[model samples]
Target: MKTFSMSPAAGERYVPVSCPVCGESRTREGWNCGSYRFARCIGCGHLYQNPQPHFDGLRARYGDDYFSYELENDANFFDLMLKGLQDAGFFELERKLGDRRRFLDIGCATGMLLAYLKNRDWRVQGVEICEPAARYGVEKRKVPIAVGTLDEAAFQDAAFSFVHFSHVIEHVPDPRAFLLEVNRVLEPGGYVITVTPNRAGLQARVFRERWRSSIADHLNLFSRRSLVRLLSECGFSPIGWKTWGGIAKGMAPNFVKAPLDRLAKLAGFGDVVLVVSQKISRKPQDPPVGPPDGAP
Candidate 1:
């Protein structure tokens, strides 16, 4: 894995703009943390940090050090268990689809999920933007991966039976265009699954701006309603959905955290949202456009 170093910017820059989901321009607000400032659209309730870095900039951030940190600090026994649960979710998705011959995983970091799917006899292919990560997948795991963005990757249309984007949508610049491309490359009855942070979750309410998930990389925030609406607009039918899992479960906590963890999981407000939808031949009607005054 290669690492590229670059000088940090002296200050943050803000760009005022209307809401992308809705055309309301009146309720834009600024989110400031130290020297960083983000222009959040109150209209559609989308929070985006300012001075968004380009693809190369992101690649530099995800170098060897980043993976080392993830492996050392993030990936543990509990993390492994959580990953198993996530793979179980995908397994259920596979059953629903009734077949799993081909699978495409976008933003497949280190190709762990693809490796898991491959074990299930699904031919796994992945598209990753970071060079080091893609190389690791190809060389270490022997997973076939296209080392680039989805739009730039060379894959035939309708090549995949299952397309997945776990925790990847928020990092994308254009969610609609991304999904449109997903639809283009998917077979007529293929399934598309996405998992991302739900802005409307209880964690968001408790942590507010300081929520760990509210970071510089997440350009879009989607609540359950908003996510469903966006998927419908992009021509996917909602088939299955699940909400939050406890953070304490990832930590070696005693009995004190157990009850709270159970409650949080029951409330479906942990920290992440998973959605499974299938691609259909007919396009669904667009969601009713909200008012221009930020009234959702």
Candidate 2:
């Protein structure tokens, strides 16, 4: 993905926020990309943009320019998402998931992944915030895409068996609320696969503020621990995870990049991470207790 330029508009408001995962207010500056800055939470080691641009301004960024970018990179994104899902054993899981093959892809730009799975006998739907991209998916790709946020889609409870979102949660200003909405719509014991840039990866550490992913579009950057913790708290139990992309293109020679990529996957410190989790079934009278304090 290319770096996005998102300087704040004149007189635009930037709201400060606490850590979404742990509700921690203590944070230290992490990095800055253009006019945007990231802060690292002292409580859970979470990284997010503080003094975030107003929601309306943030929403405005996903117009025609963003649509063009998505259109240009749809094929590459599809391949990467497919590989990530395969690495997380989604293909085998799908075969054993009985007849309830419903799938929902959030932030499904152009609905490429939805169309691909729809061809594989899965009932597919998509939620995309970009109007032009959603229209393209619906009209050109023949995929059913709702042009709105998942919460705005207002799906029925237990609507889908599988939920997937790639490079999406980081853009959300309220990721906890987003995950709760995801949990509400997903059937009990259903699966959720999340792909996002890892803040605790080699690229972020090496490139620091210059990292491509530390761009203006991303509001939150999750590491493996922080993301898994957030998922568990949001009513899901992590089953598996995979990470890749140790060195980005043009960053290193092929010989070096190849080994680093393999090593990143094996060592669990890639630039991006894909986590697969199952929705924990909650009885109507179940306690409101949270996940274990230190369970791995």
Candidate 3:
């Protein structure tokens, strides 16, 4: 895995750090790729790249070719994403929320999903960290995009009812603080869904450093236990979870690969995992005790 320290992309901005979730200084060697090494936090079992790029440095690494590459290659990317959303029970959240129309997609690159939803009449807002990416969404796609990180987006309290971001949590430097910001903007019982790589899955176990997730930019990695623990700590209630992907065993026909993939997920050995959680209502104050049934 090419790293910020070795590559010119990140420049002289890399620094060593402790685990963001557990604040643990002790770590076990998890994997090494190129010039970087990943460590598993002894306190929480979270995996992270020990010396990662500074925020500005990481931001500077993304270039204009980011979205256009997908435009040229994965033309049906959004369609596939919509299908994945349905599979992940996003529509169920829509049904449950009923009248709550606002949706926020963090790290919404090119605002494709937001633009798609906006066409369907949902009040959509997006936040993208990359300026070029965010500007494309705003200027080209005509979507409402705020160009910044989640904590810097400055959304109002309880501003949205549904929040979605795929494959972004792992890149965050501090996931607990990131989720806290996510929780702050979501209304009570609002739906939140995220997809990230599963370290406990077969892909990581088999390929080790060769897994797509073993990269310099992916700062944090989580298993089911660590993911739920972090979410619960940040006040998100569990809704649903499932492991998927990890079809890297071989190039077989879908007829063969599909069942094996399903079995892999069912047995908790998939590469990617989907988690649906919600921001629950804060604990209420003690119910008002009336004084003698109408004392002025």
Per-model TM-score versus the true fold? 0.81, 0.93, 0.87
Between candidates 1 and 2, the one scoring higher on lDDT is: 2
Would you list the C-alpha lDDT of every candidate in the order shown?
Answer: 0.67, 0.86, 0.76
Candidate numbers, best lDDT first, in rank order: 2, 3, 1
- Using alpha carbons, what is the TM-score of model 3? 0.87
Report the number of the highest-lDDT candidate.
2
lDDT of 3 by residue, 156-182 (tens): 999999999877898888887899888
Off by over 4 Å in 2: 3-7, 283-296
Runs off by more than 4 Å, candidate 3: 1-10, 249-256, 283-296
Q: lDDT at 270 for candidate 3?
A: 78
Scanning candidate 2 in windows of ten residues, the lowest lDDT window is 287-296
What is the C-alpha local distance difference test score of candidate 1?
0.67
lDDT of 2 by residue, 147-207 (tens): 9899889999999999999899999989989999999999999999999998778897788
Q: List the residue pairs that clash in candidate 3.
A: none
> What TM-score number comes out for model 1?
0.81
- Summarize candidate 1's per-residue lDDT along 1-296 as a digit string, tens digits: 11122333334333544444554565455555444444566666665554455555554555666555434432352254346346437666678666547999898867776777788888999998767777887998889989878999857889998888877887776677788889888888788888887666766666656656666666666766677777888888878776764553444465755666566557866567778788878966886776422211
